[model samples]
Target chain A: MLVIEDLQVELAGKTLLKDIDLEIRPGETHILFGPNGSGKTSLLMTIMGYPQYIVKKGKITFKGVDITHAPINERAALGIGMSYQRPPTINGLKTRQMVDICAKTKVDTEGMARSLNFGDFLDRDVNAGFSGGEIKRSELLQLKAQDPDLMLFDEPESGVDIENMALIGTTIAQILQKNPPRAEKGKPFVQQQKERTKMGLIITHTGYILDYVPADKGQVLYGGVIACAGNPREIFQCIGQMGYEECVKCTI
Target chain B: MYDLEDLKEKARQALDKKASFGGDLDLNTFDRSFVPHKYLAEEEICAIPQEEQKRLIMSGLDVTGHGRGGTYFQKDTSVIHCQSKEEGIQVIPVTEALKNHDWVKDYFWKLVPVDQDKYTASALLELHDGYVIRALPGSKSVYPIQACLYLDKENLQQNVHNLIIAEEGSELHIITGCATSPHVKRGVHVGISEFFVKKGAKLSFTMIHNWAEEMDVRPRSVARVEEGGIFINNYICMKPVRSIQMYPTTYLVGDNATAMFYSIIVGTPGSYLDIGGRIYLKNRGSRAEIIQRSISNGAHIINRGHLIGEAPEIKAHLECKGLLLKGGIIDSIPQLEGHVEGVDMSHEAAVGKVAQEEINYLMSRGLSEDQATSTIVRGFLSIDIKGLPEALKAEIDRAIDTSNKDSM
Candidate 1:
């Protein structure tokens, strides 16, 4: 479970996100939808504590603990994992080794890689020479390896083909099933980890992932604010009836 | 400078005598064994070369004996050359270490042989003070015996011969560093170092060379690894030594033997460095690995490294990467060739500028653009900083950090 209160991100002296508030409950998949440059990826990076994007005037809480200023590795160790839109290639660092390090001995690599179809990249450098799909699979393998309680997915379904789309969908669903959210009463979302397996906040411009797994909430972020929130299916239907451009025009 | 008359007179005086002690050497002990002989300097000539004795000098390598083109340096000159002394490493000049430590002395001759050229042979053969170094069976030491050679005017042609012997099961680390006094005159330097590692021996050698910016340097060195022995050589070049050309060769002659070479040749504007390493697997079960990294700016660097596995179970590897900053040119040649089966040999080479994404990402994280660029550049150079000893690795890390901060 995670909470963001009036979160704002500024980069290159420009406000990328502003006045954004979100509460992710344990065991629920929150789909963050937006058009290009809608601050979706920027929000994910802010949550993960990437140094570049200034927090400006926001607070991010992971499991009720303010992690607005945590470093990337610290966030990772705290059971927060983010699969980026574009993975970094760190030469000489083996992918398997990184998974092991991320897992912190929580999970095994062979099993994670096997489940994610990355047998060939076990010994290869981390994200080096990896195809788009391979990078996604590697991230999934790491996600499973780390077995974090909170997962942030940035365009996880962007580069996946229809064939692997099914695989991706299946794996995502399985992971969702593997870590159901906590539903305890009278406990803050911060301590919800004791009862829940895992929770996730996924960002995507295209609603293609709806073809695979059900999303609990579909929210469109414009001007760094939630313009609308509803069933992912209806939200997608709205986009279908009214193109993203028209929706943006109407919102502005 | 007095040349042929003086050298010939010395050679005639020495060679005319008979050898009552052909190979009687004092092992593990220093004794006076200065065999006065002609220090040859030829335009183009051939003579069966022998091991050299280099004297260690800590200061004064410039002021070559005075006046234009002189052959002699003052006795107290800060210049340090090989010396034959009753004290010092195993005494009696390194050239004769073979007789005292015959089994190990065989490797003393070609540390980096003085060539027929201007500096290679002259700086080595003509220098009067030199030392003979030998490591006996199972012998290991802590500190690196320091050796220095200095030159100035016309061309400081000094002959330096160094020998390192790791007898069976012996372990040793030797340091050969060259430096010049501030604002010293420029000259040419040709030096040779040869080492031999016997069965089960381990030798770690380091060469830190910082010559005058206007000097030309030629260094040729080699080592032979015997069965179960390990030899690791590291070279660090930091000064803007104008032109540098060196080829370090190693022969893995024993089964299950290992050799590693780590070299960093940094050349600034108006500088050129042709530096590399070679490993010849002449026997079964031998292995060698060569890794070279070069950073050049407004200069040219040519690096060539190769690995050879001669027989079965022999393993070898080579990795060379060059980083070119504006106006820098790099031509790298890495090769892995051998007939030995089951030999794991690979050579990877890459050339590129700083990664833009990494820079942008770091800069976004509160780091300045310069800080971002340097952080990534240091990261590139710190690739091997990971598996080193904690203290040494920390030192390396500190250096990178300092460089990064300075750039910032």
Candidate 2:
């Protein structure tokens, strides 16, 4: 579980996010709604400890440990994973190669494909020239390999085509359902569930994200504050109608 | 006690003082009759004309003493010596190997002519390529053969011809070099080398050249690759020289032949280094690759690599990248041309400074800003050392490591 208490972020000499508060727990998905440059992506990147997003104030505690300034790899080691909106393409590095790297295991490549629906192009360079849908699947595959304690999704629905949305949504559910529980050395059944790896913060912008991902709570972040909280469908309909700009105006 | 310039002056004077060490002092047969392009595509259908076979004789001499408007002469091999029993494992002067052993002299340069031009042949005859090395079948020498040449005098014209032959299934590593050591006047240093590879043979040639201040060093070399041969050429230019224009060519004449060339040119304040490799797929089903990376700071480095697929069923790839910093300049020109359709050829080039995003990503992984940048730079260079010989891999890594440390 991770908790963000009034997080304030500033970058490139500009105050981006001002006093934002949120929390994510195991087995729960939280969709953060905001428009471009409204600090939506910055908040996700900030939680993942991107060095460029300088946290000017507030505190971020992961599993009761204050980690507002932890290094990226350190955070990674602590099971904090993120799916970038525009993932970086690792040239000359193949997709399966990255899977092997992050998995740190000889993952069942065939099974992984069946799960993510990308069995045809595992040998190609990592995201070198992937389609929109393919890129989204790669992110999901990386998350499965990493199995982070806290998962942050930034616009996962951007590339999900209508034909594959249901499959992708189901694949994610399967991953969450088939969780190996928290890994504990030399422990069986009960220890496995204790390993209960977590997936928490789920951010989406287009107002159409949770049509696939059933989240614990859907909150609106407008003008750098929690503008509203309600059912996923209700919030989707509001943003679907007025957009985040009107949401901010209504917050006033 | 010998500064690079001082050494160059001495080498020039020693040559003028007369060839003290007698190695190969005969045969300056020149080929006045140029082999026209018509003759080029026309292989020896029947023992190439007597005139053509006569031109193929393994000798370093051209008539009238000049080759292709360039000066030509044999080298003085006295600089070479057996430091210990290890260097003598299978090492022999190229010319000596040719005269005493008929098979070596007859078959070595038979493919690649030292006298591809008039002066080269003339120079081959004069002093001969100074030294000849014969790594017998299955002979793996531990110590590198050191071929040192000095540009002794200023304004003096010198042409040094050399030959190396790696016999069947043999492994020979050569650390051939030339520098403007102290005593050598500010002048020109032109050194040429030609090598032959027999079946199943492997050779690692490391060439490191540091020219004296204000001196122009020009080196030209060629290697003839045979069936199942592996030739690795790693060239490093650490210091700035006036004008360095070199194009080392590898002819893959047999099937299943593999050749890889990795070169790094570090040009400093005021230097111009134009270096690259040419791989000519002369036979079917051959494979070759050339990777050239140059790092320049306040200098100019030009890397031009070309893969010429002369025959079908060949695979050739060329990748060139230039990393420039501190107002330095770099020009990368990579070309892959296939005459035949069955060949797979691709050439790409990228010119850049260290990517900021890559640096940041690496830094976020517990590396300092400097550490991150160097790691990315090293990754850019750690490309070809994967399948190289252990010694070569180590040397390449060391060079890159040193460069990384220095940049930091």
Candidate 1 lDDT score at position B107: 46
Write down the DockQ of candidate 2: 0.12
Off by over 4 Å in 2: A1-39, A46-218, A221-226, A229-252, B1-80, B83-89, B94-131, B138-160, B175-189, B210-215
Mind giving the per-residue lDDT tens digits that candidate 2 earns over B196-227? 87788988777666555555555567888889
Alpha carbon lDDT of each predicted model: 0.63, 0.63
> Residue A103 in candidate 2 has what lDDT?
62
lDDT of 1 at B71: 20
lDDT of candidate 2?
A: 0.63
RMSD of 2: 13.7
How big an interface RMSD has model 1?
Answer: 6.9
Q: Tens digits of per-residue lDDT for model 2 on A1-252? A: 788888888899888887787877766667777666677788888887888899999999888888899877677667677766676654444567556655645678768866778877687665768888888888788777766667777777787798878776655655554332335476786655444456666667665546556666777777666777767666777787887667555543
